[model samples]
Target: MSNYCIDIFEFGRHKTQEVTIGDVKMGASNPIVVQSMTTTNTNETEETVAQIKTIIDAGGQMVRMTTQGQREAKNLEHIKAQLVKEGYNQPLVADIHYNPNAANIAALHIEKVRINPGNFVDGAKKFENIDYTNESYLEELEQVKKKLIPLLNICKQNKTAIRIGTNHGSLSDRIMSRYGDTPQGMVEACMEFLRICKDEKFFNIVLSIKASNARIMVHTVRLLVQKMNEEDMYFPLHLGVTEAGEGEDGRIRSAVGIGTLLMDGIGDTIRVSLTENPEKEIPVANQIIDYINTKEGHDAIKKVDTDNYSPFKYTRHQTNAVKNIGGNNVPVVIGNNHFTKDSDYSYIADSSVIVSADKKEYPVVKYSNSNEFDFNNHELCFVKIAYSDMDDSAIQFFKQQNNVVILLTSNNSNSTIEQRAAFLHLRNHHVTTPVVIHKLYDSVFDANTQIQASCDIGPLFIDGFGDGIFIENNTENQSLVINTMFAVLQASRVRFSRPDYISCPGCGRTLFGLQDTTVLVKEKTAHLKGLKIAVMGCIVNGPGEMADADYGYVGSGPGKVTLYHQREVVKKNINQEDAIGELVALIKENGDWVEPS
Candidate 1:
């Protein structure tokens, strides 16, 4: 669109030809795009090609494979050749860093090259980690630019679409030396790179400013978009929360971070970074797109609506409903999932109140750590809970809460034993509390039996639960449950346990005792509530992951360590002999650590 973003985000105003990669296109005028990064090693051509085919078969239109070195780059042509031979004509992107030559090479076969300027530029030599208040800072800045111009040109001439990616790692040492590794510093550095690309006549570009911090990630995107808008610019923004772990938390955090931005209409493309297989990312990424553009009669978004009902739009109205539900003291079980105490549950606790129940009157209870159900002093206390669709009492309980609860139950509620058991749970629970019974696509025969026996007679329910309140009823697609739950939790006043761990998957290169350090750190800090700490391996992704954490310890060499707090390096070159004690002491100094036992 605007000239301000002409180079960094060219919308092709004159032509607006859909920018297709393989078959996926993401542009101002193009339809919503879904993409994923290959988890296969670039050097493994057979495995990589196999994975790419699987991705395409699974509905991925655009894919990215890493090209970390010349070997991988050399192998990339074969990888492309193989894909072409196999008739796998999807758009592929080469994720290359540091080596500009690699970028030039990758551009030969891949549809795009994702360049991290922070890593590509040579750090100013004269400006070594010293305070700029000293001298030589301005001179160093001039020298840094002198070095980066050539690489920028090489990319421009290749007709490559540069993904201006800014990460905590590979930060231009000059920026780190001046601003430290903070979100603002990262965003500013990325913008500067975009400015450079524009100056060098590189107009085909996509932009991403990523961080591991869920909060920071969301905020940075918001700020970047705001800044771009102020300057009257529009570019396709890639969304991701890096180092966002595997399994439950990773998915939840990515959904929260990416979902928050998409809701604000800030993201154009997205990648769900996980430590697991890249194929898993495709389904999650697609669901996010579907969730955002949910509307009646929208087929593409609706296809993933496994529940047969139109996808639910997360709007201000649902938020208002949560607010309305929070004003009650009735324990609300929103779904059939087990309620685990001390896990900071989002679905099954009354979060409206913060104080102890002993001090309050009837219907008052201690709020779950999640704080998802904040209530007024006089409002009815309702603790919302959820379970699988096969739990009948859980499903029945849905009706009592005005069907506000999420019901994940079997589609056949009365055909068999499992279905009947589920029906009983929903039927019984619906008599008193708010419950919404979501039907499962699978056979509920066995599942219903399990739920009936488990919940109906358990000590927690032996005394029998009571019907409490009823709110509203709507069946949600299971594919979007995780995203919807997170969306709902965010709308509520949910709380999360802080000072989490970010450990690496040990590889051959892993050294400096990552396993012991991680275990020791977690054991030492176990009781330290609300303090985020990371024990990471070599400086590669460690610093970035640690930036998202409150504090971190990273290995540089045998018996050498670097400590970071609040994303800024506080200590360097500490001997391994004193590393543990020193790190613990530093953490204690910040008063974020639980007293060491």
Candidate 2:
């Protein structure tokens, strides 16, 4: 069971009925608490507080103003007074990147102080490219802890919370060297700060583990939550998909990444970051939190909300598309139960096993035996549904059949016949197999949801017509044993291929239209099928990274580019203006060109 009955007081700062910051309560557990940082000069009190109030009125729960210099620190008291006089009570957070003393001074008026451990570690800012052979990461971490103590002490004295945030691009050399620029490395780095907080007996630390990729952000949170949950560190998780670009992509990526985790009951708090207006953060956060809490089977959390906002209404079509595999005609299904987990299967064939949430049983065999299934193949899986119960052998037989499409169904009382039809349409469009229906219900919902197995077989149906079909439960259904046999009869033909467009991040030595060149190549080849092209900044990792690309466009210098075919440098000094065309020619020469869109 989820620990949804959380005592909200344990996270960060405690606030009740609006603690001091301008209408913001750090611990009130508001449905949507917004926070944003100012890009303005901190010393500019008139401009800074004007921006602060604007953000406050825009529903910003917290505002952080950069205190980069000593002079900026001196301007803190003035900024604080101006904010107070303006009647803004939202918590003020200080963004201190370099100077620790700035954190000490800013804490006088701010509610929270954030410091980059990488910045203060060695009293130096190196290129951040790690030296792997150094083997002195623990030493550097010790130094970092030493540098952070005074700053943390100052914050403690001032009753301020600290954010232990990590940046992937600007990582500490020691961490990067040891962890090799991965999310786990970043988590370890944040954990170092948590260790200090533990030692100091401070409980006011909020942790943020961020990476540039949306996928990485999700994975990082999973890692952090997994680590913490195993040991049970219940610190508040501040969510952000860092360096997420402005506009729809940013919004969608943030929503998907953050929403996925929130659905899994992960995030304690969130920040929707974009290069857009700072005020835009609140609405986005509100939408996400509301969507998560009010979602199906999440009603208990929803009832706690004062606003009574409706949950996100995704079309059944959109929700069904969530599990499309290789654009096949048949959608795959994993038992909605423990059989879905990758860890349970000793020999994973076309099936997955879900680990039981209750682990009172001693071994995997004992657990499987206790359940209503036979673990003969062990590769065959079982999913728990509202009414369906089958022996483990029967479940295995069902899984062994390749033709049986498993559509994960829900037990929502409101799930309409139209929704089921829409789901079927989506499944058939994505996968080329007969779908078997299994309806799983939330423990809270009534356990009477029924499954209807329908076979509407033909050549691939168009999306519009499929969209129009209404799904109803047919009285006739195939037996589990028969379904398994059918699945075995059909072979698995779907293959997972990598997506196109691999562009290298530009470095200092990168010359000649690096960013734009890559963009142009992606745009030109956006419609191309199965073409792997590399747009690299320089020759250092260009050849290595681009090794698998059918064609490569590399920037050697200004007004000059190098083209490669199959990792062998075919031509040098290709004019930058003609580089795209020439790269296309190389792709064609490699027999991988699709006609341009």
Candidate 3:
């Protein structure tokens, strides 16, 4: 059994039992695989087949389709037939929730079946709170085992692999009554089903514990690894952050969660769930996997006081709050630019300034390499220091200035490694000044900039190392850089400047139009800063997946939507036409609504 902690600094991949799905294999010396799901209805065999082809052509090794009922389950045969006829032998995974019979049908036709353990036997929309004793909880597990045995036999007979995926939002009433919606509860939910699979002598199993919150997602996955090792079980893990909204926000969230685990050598296969087309997700997943592969054994930073820190849990390191940074304050974002006489500073207001030494704009922070700069006007000064130029004088100067924040840059080939090592040097010398991670890139492509910046800056935040982030890219789109900065912060759960939308990537079970409805929800509620609003496609992922959303807009049926106020159903089955208006009225009824300026 592997006995390694999930710490990124001490790198070692946890060896796992490799399971093959169709022609593709994952775990144990295999390269990390990329997967995506189709947003089309499963009954539309032609459209489903077309999307699968598009995903495969765009670099997805495996494709998944939703199966919510008997018809969708039966249609998997036709979908598989069409793909084989089109000369594609890519593996097809059936995504099942709340239907054991559908899972049985899917197992016979597909290469793999992904069942949500929280809802495989229990129905969604039946979230009743029950107080169960220990004996009663064991009885519930026994009942679940009876319902799950048939599907396990079918999968075994057909050589079908099983993914016992547990979502953070959808924990069963029994788990909630005991564990109260936590990472421990998530791990227990998966272990319950895994035990049944083991008892049935079915070993072809994969596991996933997903959450929209990156902190929860990271913690739960790490806890699951520890528990599995204790039990001598080595199932490959599929990593993702669910309902991570569209565009740069989605990419950054996926990277912060998935990239962090991958740095610790965790995750076998991954899927980046976005609110856009399925094909658009492939490139982002590839970028994350490719970047992690390059930094497998490279020593990025020197180890500090990690003995007091738990790699399986998150605990922010304590520091004195200098102005609006450190201690209880959220990590800040600093922008790097050379201000000119005609430059417009009004467009960017949220970011703290990081102007050059010669500029006289009186920025909140100044960046310079020389020790003779004027530090009287600014409350915070970021003295730029390269690793190669560090000496006794530089160290002494940093110790003398009470208002100085180190701006670490690199001239070495591996800038990430150099900058991180510089932070360790300060810690070793007892330098307590706060450090802002500054990375400069020459890439003109927006995707490259996002990936590189996230890889460099994400792990530092995850490790409780940085106080703020400053990114300088050569692209002409300034808004892209600004948005990416906040995206990284939001993903890290350090700060929130705008509304957070918990939108599920669409599937066959989605009622009404998901993409269009998401756009309308954002149009109306994006102004509510710091408010977490969930726009779910169906009830199966609605109440549970919207785990911590303050408000919810969930699809109940065709042209019918349900609005939720923190898990309680406030309005049930309202017309989809008037749902947005009612959601606004409900927000106003509470004290959360604000007028857009």
Candidate 4:
């Protein structure tokens, strides 16, 4: 049994207790739920209801709205009445933070209430470290539980399911003091409340552990399940990458985080958190669901021999250096046709390599379970082996071979996991051959292709499996194949050919034009390669939300913005029109700014 997955080799959904929210049921073999949160103000009943309809039409199985205080909490009654009046009976969930009374009011009026474990009775995040003795920590946990039990009781009485969501950026000062914003800290922050729920006999619970970084989001969710297993907790997971910005970047980021877990049979519900309209997020979530559904009944993957792998740690499997392809090199992206350095070129067989075969310039050997290669003569060679055809003999053939790189391909419906298992086998056998992940998509390069490639190849890079990627897709031009590969590599955090952006999907609390502002920030900063910039809707989770970003643009109020250099506030409450220039000035002052090429 794997800590991250129910069974690392077996392809199936992670079994969890069913949580009923009004008419919708989630987890435990239920259709993986698709969900989105509204950006419309909750008090505007008409607008909220209309947006809910649009979200449902766009395939949102459940809709969530922000309820910050008594005003928004009470307004839900009118919203619910309006939705029911229009013959729309979809379940409604209230997103609660920093208010227990709002959660109690929401529990009585809505189908579900989500409480941030970081805020519910926990000390506010001052980002200060408090060295807590064991006695002090336990006492604080007890006090927090005593305060939360009342909300759990209200939820139980109302038959309302509760989701304890742990956002990476919003971890409280107490939790962060000891665990320091890590995967273990995220799990424990959620678990303290879950333990209270258990003690109070409140069983209807769903859980979420999210981050802006796609790789961290995946790692924490995997670790959450592992920790839950140890504690006998099987709460359903709500998978998402918080603040995943709009357009293809948002889609690719969501896929890399959510798709990686879904491949391992984790996640009960998913939301593609985009900075655009909430309704636009549903179709992207649907695409990820449809793509992952294709992995269910594939040919079984062979069980790995010895798993010396750590789910919490990211250590690229060791391999011999093959030029710029592997061994501490950033993972390369390869196109089917000849391309530049980052976009490397590859040959499928000897027929195409015939011209270069004599010179052994870039020759490849197709393994038919035998090796007749002139290793002594060639300085370097790429050995291709069907991942499905690999066994002890194949591993033994390449175990001690020098000047060799492995090209892995698979036809199994198991998708990425099949290739993953092959990587494990090589690692177990002490093979240091650099590996390149290869996939052939029969369809043209489109939205599906972008999502599918990020899902398949991105995870390998996130988990440190493949040394390079070679993608073959039916497209009219080479740009489709080459462009998509670089995007996947960038999303995977294995390489960066563009500026990385993190922007939150705005909620009712957001008081500015988040979508347009995010676009503006991206347009201005897109040329800063390797720089991470965050465009957040509001300060509630903004300053903390950017994670490792070098700069942040946070909406502090209507027509106002705040600029941050990492976590320190550089400028507070500047006019929206002046924010971009001030941000650029801050970047330049910090020695991070470079002129656009």
Best by lDDT: 4
Looking at model 3, residue 400 earns an lDDT score of 77
Give the count of colliding residue pairs in each prediction: 73, 25, 1, 0
Pairwise TM-score winner, candidates 1 and 4: 4
Model 3 Cα shift for residue 380 (angstroms): 3.4
- Sorted by lDDT (best first), the order is 4, 3, 1, 2
- The CA lDDT of each predicted structure is 0.52, 0.50, 0.80, 0.84
| Model number with the top TM-score | 4
TM-score of each: 0.59, 0.55, 0.89, 0.96
Ranked by lDDT, the better of candidates 2 and 3 is 3
Candidate no. 4 TM-score: 0.96
For residues 154-262, what per-residue lDDT tens digits would candidate 2 score against the true structure?
7667777777776554456676667765767777777888788778777677667764444455566667655665555666667766534343334544565565455
Q: Encode model 1's per-residue lDDT on 213-293: one tens digit a residue.
A: 655565566566656666545667888877655555456556656655554455677887765556777777776666544
Which regions of candidate 3 are displaced past 4 Å? 1-7, 10-12, 125-127, 297-301, 338-379, 385-401, 409-431
Q: How many clashes does the backbone of model 2 have?
A: 25
Error of 1 at 531 (Å): 4.5
Write candidate 4's Cα lDDT for 1-597 as tens digits.
Answer: 456676777778889999899999998989999999999999999999999999998878899999989899999999999899888898999998888888889888989999998877763567889999999999989888877888888877889899999999889888998899788899999998888888888989999998998888888888889888989989899999999889988889889889998987999999999999899998889889899899888887778764577667687889888776688987766666444444556443325341121223566677873366676776667777877778778887787677777888888776688888888888888888899898888877788888988888788888889888888764667676777788788787888899999899999989888898888888888889999999888766787777698899988888999898898888999999999989989989999888987
